[model samples]
Target: MSTGIVLHHLVDSRSQRVLWLLASPLSGEELQIPYTLKIYQRTPTKQAPPELAQVHPLGKSPVITDGDLVVAESGAIVEYLLQKYGNGRFQPPSEGLVKNIYYTHYAEGTLQNLLSNWRIYGMIGERAPWPLTYLSRIIMSKAQHAVLLPTIEASTAMVEKDLEESKTIWFAGGSEPTSADFMMLLPLEILPRAMGERIPKKIKEWVDAAHRRPAYQRALKAGGEYAYAKLLPEASEQ
Candidate 1:
């Protein structure tokens, strides 16, 4: 067996963020950390494969194995990699530390859950029978507007306000991307698609800039087709 970090990635999922971070520069230099990529395909219904459960009990993507140690969850995998191989990069300074941690947890702890429910509602609507499809869609739409949209808007607005106040494109307000950036990318990209509108200007710009990065491009190339890569600014050109 190879003795490096093994990333079990599910296509078009939050695992893409981990792939981007792995391909990202650890320091000022453009160097990507060495790792083995194990790709998994989602089911026809867009669910993770059962094989993933053998790697972690959750059967989720974005899990990593460093020898005997297994790290799961997107945020935890990001922190673990940065802790072990960051070489003093991808962390915020004292002033930005609090914001970094808040946004990092906020991505998964709050925003992801809202967006996930939105996706589940969409799936429910899509899978409904012909007789119930319209009704189901209406019901799901009502549920989303009631339970998901308000919180999503509030959270995105909070991010917008923070970015506007900081006067920087990045959440942590640093010259380089940090763990917060890695952790937040997936949800931010999903936000606009989920809402159909109400993508705050700053957040849209942030996601665009993230897509245009060299590291992000590299991750896409190596990770095969990602659903969100269509959001790339020059996607038409590609």
Candidate 2:
């Protein structure tokens, strides 16, 4: 008895994971729920376009409009889906859950933030003049090494530990994808581009498993040109 929702999606944004969630509900009519997709392309600088700001002041991707309700932020959108449509699937009850609840917060703010810093410094190094910017490049490299790279390393290790100890290919959920998988996939899928040789086996396995899901492929097909979707060889969609 919920109104149809409108997802304001960006091709390579965190919205991709939300697309997966909508395409693949763990159970019930979540998939059958009426929803529409509003696609936005990034500007030349790889940032969300100004048009998105009209939807909300912040103008970030992954915003949803359900009737008069406008929701922004990936984590909040996931929670909204779970509340309105999940029907107690893909997560545990509100109390006494660790990874399930913890990830909803950390996935966007902490994990993505670390990776963004790496990209920022890399961009700085790229734009720095080769001969004239030698000193600038050194400073940027030092800054990257001193802060961003270490943070990515530590976060990567923490995710590895969480996966290895959980004994589940997916993050918090046991043997099956959860809301955490949807939230966490954004970071893991980018490992090939973000970290390259530093990609961990456990994370690769997790992502491979996700790729194999028919729903994931369908989402990718509809979502269009996800920058990191092909990082690893994805299974052919059936």
**Which candidate ranks first by lDDT, i.e. highest?**
1
lDDT of 1 by residue, 1-238 (tens): 4577888999989999999988787622544556788999989977899999999999999899888899998989889888889888887877888999998898899998899899899889878999999999999989988988888888888989987876467888887778889988888887765666667777777888788789898899978669876753432243
lDDT of 2 by residue, 96-188 (tens): 267877776888888887777667877787787768477777787788778877777888898888888775676774656667788888888
**lDDT against the true structure, each candidate:** 0.83, 0.78
Q: List the residue pairs that clash in candidate 2.
A: none
Task: Give stretches of model 2 more than 4 Å off.
Answer: 1-3, 26-31, 93-96, 128-132, 234-238
- What is the clash tally of candidate 2? 0
- How many steric clashes does model 1 contain? 0
Against the true structure, candidate 2 reaches a TM-score of 0.88
Q: What is the TM-score of each candidate against the true structure?
A: 0.91, 0.88
